[model samples]
Structures are given as structure tokens and as C-alpha cells.
Target: MNNAVTIVRVSLNDANTLLELSRKTFFDAFLSTNNPADMEAYASTAFTLPKFQFELINPNSAFYFALVDNEIAGYIKLNYVDAQTELQDPDALEIERIYVLNDFQGQQIGKQLINLAIQTAVDKNLKYIWLGVWEHNTKAIKFYRSKGFEQFGSHPFMLGSDKQTDILMKKEL
Candidate 1:
């Protein structure tokens, strides 16, 4: 792949594309280590058209698609203020989701997406950026740590009926 990557802000009209990519990337990332029933249940509800539509239109939430050579290779979701899943800090930005296609891993696509998120937060004068990663995802935790994010807390995440722990990490700007 060439070094021709671009991050495009997702719009309402891109709901269908976003939904499909969201489901595909989420499944590729977690399906292997998770229960099939739980994965299916979560995907059915979380990756639907209506859900994407709502998120796409939400004023405090933003989504972006990372395109490599004009093909969607990854995506990121950011939530601000009340739209944040946990701490509703107006001065903070929450990275609710960041996923890169399995085929696109080890290509720095994830890092590029993260840089975009950091730029976005800085542009808004946000105090800090925070995110939740599954505790068992050591790779992701290491990545976040490399970006200067420190573990601050943890919260329970529901993957369908299964409750799991997500380590909260944050980077102070």
C-alpha cells in the first residue's frame, strides 16, 4: 500500500457505509476471543443503520473514516461532553472507538487515526482525551501508553449479556 491515507469526516449520507465498515472491523477485532452469541448480539444492535444515523447526526459526536489508497482501512469515533459514554466533562474529549481493518494492521493506520483525534481535541482546546479499552487487549493498551495515555480507571462494559472490564486511559493536553 502506498502512503496515501486520508481521514474523512463521516456525514449522515455515509451512514450505510459506516455501518458496514463498523460491523466488519468490530467483528474482525474481537470475534475470535469473544463468545459468538455475545458478538452477534452486540453487533446486531451497535452496527445498525439507525444507530449510525443517530451518531452521525449527533452534534457532540464525530466519526471519521481512514482511507488508504481510497479504500476504507480504519475508523475512529469521538464523543464530547454529554455524548461521552462515561465522564461527561465538557473540557474533555472521549475516543469512543478506534479500529483498523485486520488486513491493514501494522501499517500505522491506527496511529494516523489517533493523531487526527489528538489534533481535533487540541483544536477544540480540550483539556484531555480519554478512552476505554478492553482489559485483555494488551496490544491496544500498549499502543495507548506509547501515545502518553495513562490508565486512570476502569468501567464495566456490556458485550451483550457478558459484562467485561474496560481500562480507562487518558492523555492530558
Candidate 2:
């Protein structure tokens, strides 16, 4: 077990670990929803094992993990998204996902991830860092706000077998 937390690029072999972390983090983040089926589907689909593995090995995408004591405490995904259909700057780098384990909540792990994403985006010469967060995720929304993210637009998202909306947030680096 390491004393200090470490963030590192994930490898294809870490797929199973990533899925497990996603499941735990999603359930923890959305405990108020109380919808097991929806949670399971999300953890297995958007954060599926195969997809996680692909991102780990993908040249165009970078997935980072916060490791504590050699165990994954949280993870973040960064990738490019075409902005042709949106108002956002085409040079913005999309932060696809950020999730922390249940027990790690409220420990500033999320902020750490955000800072990492901003640094990564800047390193790639991206103009901004963007992410889509569930409108219902008030905690996340507030966290983003505290980190200087402003609402840019809305996007459709699936939740509990129903269509929902998510707010797109952006932070200029």
C-alpha cells in the first residue's frame, strides 16, 4: 500500500479493475437514484470491460487512475470529441468521465482529477476542458462550479431506461 496517492495511465490489463471501479463509483455517486438496474447497465456499458480496455490501449484516448495503496481509488477519461454539431470550441478536449470510489468521496479526489485533466489538456494545447454531467448530480455540478466550470449547454443522456438531460460544462485552461 502506498502512502501517497498516485495517478497513472491505465493499461489494457487493467480493464477488469476499471470496470469494478466504475461500478463502485457509479453506485456511490448515484446512491440517491436507488435504481440498481440502471446502475448495472451503465457500469457495464459505457464503462464496459471491453471499452475500458480499448481506451487503455488506444492512442487517441488517455485514461488515468488515482491509485491509493496500490488499489484504484478513482479514474478519469480524456479524449477528443468532434465539435462540428455543437457551439463549443472545436479545440476543446472532452473529459469523458471522472469517478471516485465510495469511500474516497469528499476527499478532494475529484478535484485532483480535474486538475489533472486541465494539465493534460494544456499539455496537448487544447483551448478548454469540457465534460457532460448529469443535471441531477447536484454534488458533481457544484464541484464543477467550484473548480471554475461554467455551464455551456445541455445534452441528452439515458437514465433508468428513460431519456434525461445533462449539462455540458467547460473550463478554459
Question: Which residue runs does candidate 1 get wrong by more than 4 Å?
Answer: none
Q: CA lDDT, every prediction? A: 0.93, 0.78
| 1-173: candidate 1 lDDT, tens digit per residue | 55778999999999999998888888888989999999999899888888889989999999999998789999999999999998899999999999999988889989999999899999999999999999999999999998999999999999999999999999999
Q: Please, what is the TM-score per model? A: 0.97, 0.86
Q: List the residue pairs that clash in candidate 2.
A: none
Q: Which ten residues in a row have the lowest lDDT in candidate 1?
A: 1-10
RMSD in Å for model 1: 1.1
User: What is the C-alpha lDDT profile of model 2 across 1-173, one tens digit per residue?
Assistant: 22467899887877887777777777877866757787666565776777667667766677789887787889988776542224445577787788888787777777888889888778878888878888888988999999999998998987667677989998988
lDDT for residue 93 in candidate 2, whole number 0-100: 79
Could you tell me the lDDT of residue 119 within candidate 1?
A: 94
